[model samples]
Every structure is written in structure tokens, then in C-alpha cells.
Target: MNIEELASILRNNYTNADKGNKVSAIHAFGVQYANEIKENNYLATEIIKKSGLNESYSTELSKGIKLYDYMKNMSTDVENDTEHELLSKLPWCEIAAIAMYKNDKNYKYTPTEVKNLPLVVLAKKIKKAESPSIGTELRECSNDMTTDYHRKTRNLFIRENDLYYLSENGIKYVEENFSYMISDDIDMPLNQILYGPPGTGKTYFLGKIKNQIMEYNKKVFAKKQSVKENIMDLSWSEIIALGMYKANKTNSYKPNELYKLEYIKEYIDDKKENGGATPECSLRSDLMRNSIKCDALSESGKTGNDYFEYEISKKVYKLSQNGIDMVENALSKYINPSDKKEINEDDFCKFITFHQSYSYEDFIIGIRPDTDYDGGLKFKEKRGIFKIICDDALNNPDYKYLITIDEINRGNISKIFGELITLIEANKRWGNEEQQKLTLPTGGTLCVPNNLYIVGTMNTADKSLALLDVALRRRFEFVPKYPVYDIDGIYYVDFLKKLNETILLKKKKADYLIGHAYFMDKKKQPKLQDILNKKVIPLLMEYFNGDKGCVAEILKAADANIVFKDTFHLEVI
Candidate 1:
């Protein structure tokens, strides 16, 4: 059963043991199981002595110690008394305090409400709190809370070993707001293709949802986290740095050289540049290589080996951006279709797949042959590297975790985002079956897990991204995020407003307007004049491109003029 179900059963069985008579009778039984982790009779005795109801079942509980198994065998009466007495001893106030940790952008928890709660109430409170991840101590203590409301509150938010979610609203919320694309059934390859129009938030949102689902695994692999998984997630600029390390070395060649290995490395490395490498992030800079695997033979209509030796032991393969995607698709096949289940066509996020070049580090290039380095010095993540991180954080009793991916669609669509399209769907994971692998262009394959999600992001304006093929577009779910009409924490609406007015005046339905993103200023707000004169005015002129009269007409509406004598204020570069 799921953690939520388990929490409910445990909570129900434990109620009413807090009262004087019930406590006296239940204390001993509670002590026996509580001390199982320690195997110390003295500790067990000490805890049991404090209980109003001492349990005689302690020895048997300590021997098996598996909560689910024990609960299955329990007569409702024994389980309830034992849990309530245990709740009486837990420090609810401390857990409440810890669960209330806060950060700059994410304030999902409040410190004030939890400070003075009674132990039993606090146990329930902590359980009900839904952070991205939670800890063992908190999970146990909350599980021990006997109040049905309190226990169910914790259960209302589901847990996947290291992840957390608002249980009741979890799936719906993710389908609507998360970045990864989710489906109810299995479809190979097309289940998700990051390079298409829906690539951005679709990839990212789905990835996050997968993380939350992962927590349900009963293994207890890692502790939980107290904060939102990507609260201080890297900005576009920071993301570029994560994947910008020298791929040539891993390609088994020296920089500025011409080995097939070096060729592939050079192609992948060229993705993060829009120009002279401006201080502004270069992630949205320029398209790196047409294919993740830079095989000259393929480029020249021939094909062969796609990888090389990395330093000594590891084999580094150069997957074309398309190659990378095929690999992900193959893996997704392993994840989604292994059970031979029927699926509907509408499961995919329909997209207009058009051809476009791509940059480095987007999800289109799922895996690359880069020098894997962990530890002191030697540069961390390269600019535009796409990697997913899975871990936990401390919320209550302990920490929770998250799995994250940045810029999901910057590479070649078909190559990079392979099998994830199928694996990410909710209904398609498996039915009493095992995992499989998706094949890549170079004959490589990848595997997907039920709890893993694929999330990615894209700027709709990029040139390379527009060229996705129809085959790939039919797989993912895309949620269009226009520039916000007004500024929130990230983007703004002033420029977007002025720009849209100008576009409408020229052609009402041209699908062109100032992006809601133009006015975004994390560091400071842009002045009205600065936006109009510098950023907007010139762009409007570019909109008309060569039509001087139409451009002049729109400028007058915004109260600005061309610089020529009869035009806008004049100045020649």
C-alpha cells in the first residue's frame, strides 16, 4: 500500500491511548517496539515505565519491527493503544519548529502555527505538512500520531521515499503546473520530445512530478528535504556553466584538434555562445551543433563509431542531439510499453513540429560524453549541461529531496529526448513487469524509472528550436507560458503591453508581440523611458523591418518618433 494508506491505518489504530487509563495500559507495549532500533532492554524499560499503559507486545514487535507486517497481524485494539502511548512521549513542538523552515522565494511553511502544539497534535501537524521531502524521525513521529485528522493530514500529502507532494491535489496540480509531461498510458518515443514547442515548462514540470511520485517507493533510500526542491534553482546563466566543461577530453582528443572525438566534443561545446560570451547568460545564445554526434561520415552521408575512450576506463560516446533523443526514447520504451498496455493517442502534448537549429545543454541532448568530475576544484557543472539530480532535504524529523532538470529543449529534438516521452506518463509505468531500454542512433540505450520525470524549458523565439519533426511533436504535453502581463518575481508586463499594442496596430493576428519576458529584471526594474526608447522602439522598427511609414505611425502612438528630420530623433552610428 502507499505511504498515505499506511499513515491512515497507523493513526486510526493509535487513537485514545493518551487518556489516563488508556495510557497506563498502552505504555509497556509502546516501549517494546520503540526500542527495536536499539535492541536495548534498559532503554525499552525506561520508555515503558513512563507509559500509562505498558505494552506486553514489545518483545514480539521488536523481533519483527516491520510496521506494515506488524499492522497486518495486529488486532485493532493492540495497534491503537501502542501508538497513542508512543505519541504521548514524542516532542511535537520541536518537530513543528523544524518543519517551519523558510527561504527567500519559497515560504510553504509557517513557523508561528507550529510552536506550541501538543505532542500528539504536533505529530499530526508535521505529517500533514507537505514539503518537497521529509525525514525519518518526522515520518515515524507523524505516523505514531493517533488522531485520524492528524495522521490523514500527513497522508493527504504523499511521500515517495525522498520526495513529497500534496496528496489530494498532487496529481492534478502536477498535470496543470509541473514542467514534466505525464500520461495515463504507454507510447514509445513520442511520449515526450523536449525540442518541440512545449519543451520548456513541459519538460521541467513533468520532471518535478516524477520526483514526488518517487517518494512512494518503500525502500526508504534517502532522507527528506524541508524546502521546495528547486527553490533557488539555477538561473539560465548558471545553467550554461554547468555543461560548458571541455568535452574534447572526454571525446579522447585535444582541444583545437580534428579527431572524430574532438569533432563531436567541439560541436557539443559550441552550443553556449551567442557572441563574445557576454556577462549575460549564454544559454539562450546560439545553436551549437545540428547533431549531438558529430560524425563526419553522417555529416558527409556516412556513419560509423559514435564514441571514444575517456582518459582511461570510461567509454565516452558522442550522441548526436538526435542520437541523444533516440536513446531517451529507447529508455522510455523500456519504462512505458514493457507490459503491452493499450494507450490513447491524445496522451501526447500536441505540437507544431517545425525545423530549427538548437543550442547546447537543452534536454534535446539528454546524455553526452563529458568528463565526469566530482569534488574539489576542476570546475563543476558546465554551461548548458542537462542532468537530473535526485536527493532529499530536512523538513520534519528529517530532510526531503527532489530531482531537477534545466532547459529541457535546447538540443536536437529527436536525438536528445529519447524514451522519456513514454516513461513519464502516469498510467504507463508498468503492470507486474520489469524495466527495458531504448536504443539510440549509435545503438546505445537508456532506462527510465517510474518515479523519474522529464522536465525542460525553451524560449519560443529561438531559431534552432522551431524545426522539430512531426513524429516528435505528437508525444509531449506543452503548457504555453506567455510573458506574464505584469511583473511577479520573475517577468514583467509593461514592455509586453506596449509591444502588443504596436503589433496589433500593424497586424492583429500575426502571432508576434513583445514577449512577457522582455521586462523581467531580477536585479532592478527597468525605467519606463529605458524600456520604450532603448528596448522597445528599436525592436518595433525591426518589426516593420523595412516599412518606414508603418513604423513611424506606431511610434507616434507610444509618443515616440523616429530620429530622422521628419522621422524619429536623428543619430547615425
Candidate 2:
């Protein structure tokens, strides 16, 4: 029986048993399935030992059973009784307050009704009060809470003396908002290629990896944006508060008090007027979007708030004097006059891939015609994606940008990359001591940044790695992806293994064999006959170049009743 069914039976049988007998039965069962329990969950072993039960049955009912075991143990503790009892009877307002307290941002503004009250005191009031309308209080409090500076900043409208109020609407708002954090995980290889035989899901795997890369970038950006500058700037109490919030997100733990101060709650009235639009943010947004479109960035969409400041920093480094003035005018709307300063756009750039016919001019700094403000055409030195992204990374030092090349091998690496190929080396990366800054054809120097990562996808089934540029080959790390086997309860995987063994022994090669992914179906099991006729037989026919007899032999070995026809098709008998 499956674990769920087994668990249900155990629960039902023990529901009405004597407490002492139930504990005894649990211990007995644990001892009975000790080996299987040990293999399944490590946590279950600890729970079983602590509960005075045999370790064997822990694995079978860990999810449902261990939770009850934990509660029973906790309730027996004398010291936790008062806090636990109060926690069990908390009103919804106190519960909401406890949840909101975990976030540090919520401490920026307290409700006017509770303005002078300490967090603990307010929580007690919430717990003791009857028919408490926390939402109505918050609405009344908001009218007197906002300051002039709060009105100016769109993201911080509800801030008073810096302690945010908790209400039903506030809770919903925080829940809806996506948490941004810069990824702490940077375990990716400097350069790696995903390569495998035909239809082995190599390309599909590349897309998945790309998503992870984006997510990493998003997380880092999110966490970084959580507080001003770095999280190191937060005080000890604030750091502790943030940690509690993260723990709550993971464990779904409720507060012992009616309210807690371990989280942050931001009150964003989305309909609240977000101040007058500053021309700078709007112009910069337009410029970034236009830049992405002009360079033909694939899948370019609206960027998040975390990307806003960084994108503007890049634009400053790339645009001319006339462009800088326009940006300064826009910047004037949001930033204080004293804080406004010129930024160099000389190095930052977004990358775009040239599908075909890319040359030095397209890949590097080249003269391009552009219309002047007066509608007159003029020639200007246009920088490429490599120079731009690298420039931005050098300036920020913290932010990382990725330039992905789909079907990287299809491009003429030597012609497109030019002198940059040597610079692509790990040692030659921008921050390295031995970094090479080469003078371009236009008499300008360029360097690739250490923070910038280059990601690309390659299909070995279409072309051999031997066809790749030797220099490029040596620079990148190639990860081989062969056909997979050992899919649990998947007979098709075993059949493919047998077929591959035959191919490797007879044809003396592995690449010609079938990939296990071709038979994968997690949602609904596919028919063996359908898999062969539509997917398997056709692939085999192509691999053997219509050698029907050879295909038939391989099929028979795998116990397939499909027949190869003169039409170069497969049909199940």
C-alpha cells in the first residue's frame, strides 16, 4: 500500500483507542517497520525516539503522526502552559498583529489609536477586546499618519514616525506583494554547456537552468531592495525581526502572544495617490524599455522596482551629454537636489544576440546613423551588448548581468567575438589583476566584468563539438547529458536500456541510442503501443536510416510487437 493509505488506516484504527494503549501500539508499529522507517525520514527517527515509540513505524506515518506526537509532548511542559493557552484563544486582530510584527517595515508606523502603545501592550488590548474592528481603526489612523515626505515617496505612503499599523487590508497587501531578495546562492559554473544526444531533453533542460539563473538574479535584487543599501545597515533588533519573519514564512508558526514583533508589515494603499509623477523615473523607464527594444533583446518586458535604479545607472553610462541633461530633468522630480549627481553611462549596456551575419561593427563599438533633436541625421559610435553590460557591472561591482546565446554554435565565434574571445577567459575578466583592456577599432578601450555571466545553449545532436572554435571550446566547461535510465516503475526506461545495450554492442556507439525522457509521463501513464508507434519506432527508423530489419530486431528484443513498414512508418500488431 502507498504511504498515504497506510497512514490513513493507522490513524483511523488508533483514533478512539485508550491513550496509553495508542502510545503502546505506536511504539509496537515503529519497531515492526524499523528498516523502512530508517530509510525514509531522518526527522522521523528523532521524533520516534523522543516519543518513546519504536523507530520502524515513524516513516509510515511521519507527516500526520509526528505532529500529534509533538503537540502531546509540548502540552505536558509546565512552563509553556500560560503562553500556549493565551495563544490558543487569540482574536483575529491579535493574530494579524502578530503576523505583521515579524516584518521590520511595519515598525515604521503604528496605528494612531495605538501610536503611544508598545507592541506588547497593543497586542494585549487586541487579545482582551471584544468586537475589535482593527480595519476600521486602521482606516481612521491612516488619515493622520502620512507625512509630507511619505506623500512624496510612492513606496512609503503609510509611514508616520516609522511604525506601520496592522489591519486586514494591510495583511492582504503584504501577502500579495512579491518578496524580493538577491540570491545568496552563486554555485553556478563560470561557463558550462548542456550537451546530449537527439531528443534527450537537453534543450528543455537549458530553459529550466535559464529560469533558475533569472530567479537567482531576482532574489538577490529582492533581498537587496528590502532595506536601504545593505542588510548590514539594519540594527540587531531589526535583523532579529527579519529572521523571525523568514522563519514564520517557512514553518507557519503562530505567535505565543496575541501579537508578536518578529515580522514586517507594509501598508500600501495602491489607490492612495502616489504623488506627482517625476519625469526622470518615467523618462528613464521609457529609455530602458526603448533601449531593450532597439537592441532586439529577446523576451524583454517591464522591469521590477529593484531593477529601476540599476537600469538608470546603466543609461547614465551610455547616453550622451544631451541625453544626460534630459535624464537630470527627470531625476529632479523624485530625488532631492543635493542627492542628484552625474552618472557615467560609458560602460553599461544590455545584450542582444545577432542571429546571423554579425560582424565586428555589430559586436563592438561602431558608427551608426541617428536622428538629432532637430530631426537631422548624424553618425555616432554605438556600443555593443558586451561593452555595455560589462561597463555597468564594473561601476556597480555588486550587480550581475547575463547575456544568453541560444544556439551559440550556429554563430561564427571567431568573427563575432573577435579579440573579445581571449577576454572571455576567467583570468581576463574585468576585476582580475591580469585583465586585458584592449583598444577597439574606434580607439576606445573595453573590458569584460567579473560579475557578468555568459550563458548559452548548444544542441550536440545538430553539430559536433569538434566544429566549435578551439579557443571557445577551451574557455567553456562542457557538461554532457546522455540518455537517462532507472525511472522507478517505468518499464519503458528498462526497455530503452535494453535497446541502448543492443545499439552500443552492435553499432559500437551510445549516441545512436534512445533517450529515457522520450517515455516519461508523470501525469498519466502512456500506452506502450502508442509510445512505440508515434515516438520510438520513428526515432529508430531515422537512426538506422530506414534499415527496417535492424529496427525490427531491436524492437523484438524490447518485447515490442510493433512492425516497421515499407512506408518508413511503425504500426502495432
Q: What number of clashing residue pairs does each candidate have, in the order they appear?
A: 118, 43
Q: When superposed on Cα atoms, how far off is each prediction in RMSD? A: 26.5, 19.2
Tens-place lDDT per residue, model 1, 217-324, is 211221111111221232332222212212322232222232222222222322212111332232112112222333332444322222221222332232233433
Give the worst 10-residue stretch by lDDT in candidate 2.
Answer: 264-273
lDDT per residue, candidate 2, 108-155, as tens digits? Answer: 433422322223233444355543444433333332254433221112
**lDDT value for model 1:** 0.34
The 0-to-1 C-alpha lDDT of every candidate, in the order given, reads 0.34, 0.50
